[model samples]
Target: MRPFAYERAATAEDALRRHAAGDGAVAYLGGGTNLVDLMRLGVAMPARLVDVARLPYDRIEHRADGGLVIGAAVRNSDLAADLGVRADHPLLSQALLSGASGQIRNQATVGGNLLQRTRCPYFQDISKACNKRDPGSGCPAIEGDHENLAILDHSPECVATHPSDMAVALAALDARVRVRQPDGEDVVPLERLYRSPGDDPSRDTTLAPGDLITGVEVPAPLRMPARYRKVRERASFAFALVSVAAALDVSGGSVRDCRIALGGVAPRPWRAHRAEDALRGRPATPGSFRAAAEAELAAADPLPGNAYKVPLAVNLVAAVLTDLAGEAS
Candidate 1:
């Protein structure tokens, strides 16, 4: 690993000032889970790391409106083990437990998970040609081992999938990120925080050079039946092949309201707006769930190697929604 300086900031202001002094070559360290791995691989070579893991943002607050304000530094294990989170937002808790291992979860933070880079092999191997690693260098994954790559919102420049299970649940919950910007604080919707791999694959998120995520604000719980289901090659420590985070409200055998987001099929956690639109007033049946899944996946454009992801994602979405509908009933 390359030599670098590290400093733990006592407050958000101190972290921001230190980063600003580094002139855009500094990275904020939350848990050092992802950043350290990238640094060792030489994929990321930040001149300095401003440690923000100890910044005064490690608490999870339950609001009066039945929502949550989760601190950026809250460990994944803590968040998943919180009784309030398990009762109110079971899907989020499920997602947290489904990721990594017990030890890593204990060390990983909410902010670090959201900002984790893609696990694309090409991006990790500095010897390979990866557009995300080097703009315009080329994306060999397009014609290489892309069995786990993206099927939606991908461009010629890149086909990498975002690897955060937590973000997918947050997207379904309509959570917003609280950021400490260079000038002031700002709150951005979770979906808006990520960027699809367009012409510029180098940039993963919409955060500015000096922006720091302090916390996430989840809206009031819908109290509907929700579920998070993931399909992977193995049982543990494996990223999702396809996953669904869904909530359904059924009344009189009809879908009253719903929220759905898909992971492992897109550059970002894909909000299933088309599926939600199709199911809002439809009968809560297997056929309706299948149709809704199909509607959302109609725009999928997968590469030859990963074309099977399309049908896999479709079936997964349908099955998850069907189960959620059953719970609602």
Candidate 2:
């Protein structure tokens, strides 16, 4: 609970200006669901809070091509309940609903959801050595309680998993983030938006100092069967041990096209390109599904505590794709 100045911005320009005026010590407020929690834990201490929740980015626009432009300020509950979202991109809607509780979802915005930090105990404690919290200090999670940490695309410096269920679906859908940056506006692919911990575990995203996510542009609907399945320690409110967001298209008992993205297994939403490549043109069978999933997970390098995530992810992927294949059949 550090003392900080707060200002509400009426426009994106205003928000950016306010952030700049803070001299790089500002955080954009969007619902305050995740950011506030971190602040209370003393993990984040911003000198100023630019309230971007009031910005004019609160609408979900339906494109003629069956795509959608979802505003950053749109609440998770609203996005999940949108009729167009339910009918067209059911996976996205399903992922949103599967996340936090109804009350939290009511206040959590799309942008905030994407920006939520990991729930890693070491990272949150502040007393522990967390590379993400203090670069080069060390990542105790690597040898500490890492049962829920990453198994894919992880480095020795960091094994923390991205906690956004919505992001996994967006990666599968090939969504792009529209950002208002210091230079100008740019549309960045969802996959490119995040970078692996690599050598710099402190930086979660590729966004520069003054980049603001304006909205997410999901490309045209798949018009095919899709599913989002999550496995957690509990029934609800718990983060996924492993989650799969998958869409499959089948014709003549063969896979036509498919997209897959994995969460809770990597530093970012891991697009299962290897799996997709293996499944395309293959028979739409459980065996094929398993093989594709295995191909994608072959590169997994898991720690002792989190090694179970590898098999969990493999089975979850096969099961989800199987369910979607059944629906298509």
Pairs that collide in candidate 1 are none
Question: Candidate 2: worst 10 consecutive residues by lDDT?
Answer: 9-18
Off by over 4 Å in 1: none
lDDT for position 3 in model 1:
85
Give the clash count for each candidate: 0, 0
> Model 1: per-residue lDDT, tens digit, 1-329?
88888998888989989999997779999888889999999999998899999998999999998799999999999999999999998999998999998988999999999999999999999999999998989999998999999999999999999999999999999999999987899999999999987899999999988789999999998799999999999988999988999999999999999999999988899999999999999999989999999998999998999999889988998898889887888
Residue 43 CA displacement from its true place in model 2, Å = 0.2
TM-score: model 2 vs. ground truth: 0.99
Q: After superposition, how far is residue 259 of candidate 2 from its true place, in Å?
A: 0.8
Error of 2 at 321 (Å): 1.2
Q: Cα RMSD to native, each candidate?
A: 0.8, 0.8
lDDT of 2 by residue, 183-278 (tens): 789999999999999989888899987689999999999999999999999999989999999999999999999999999999899999999999
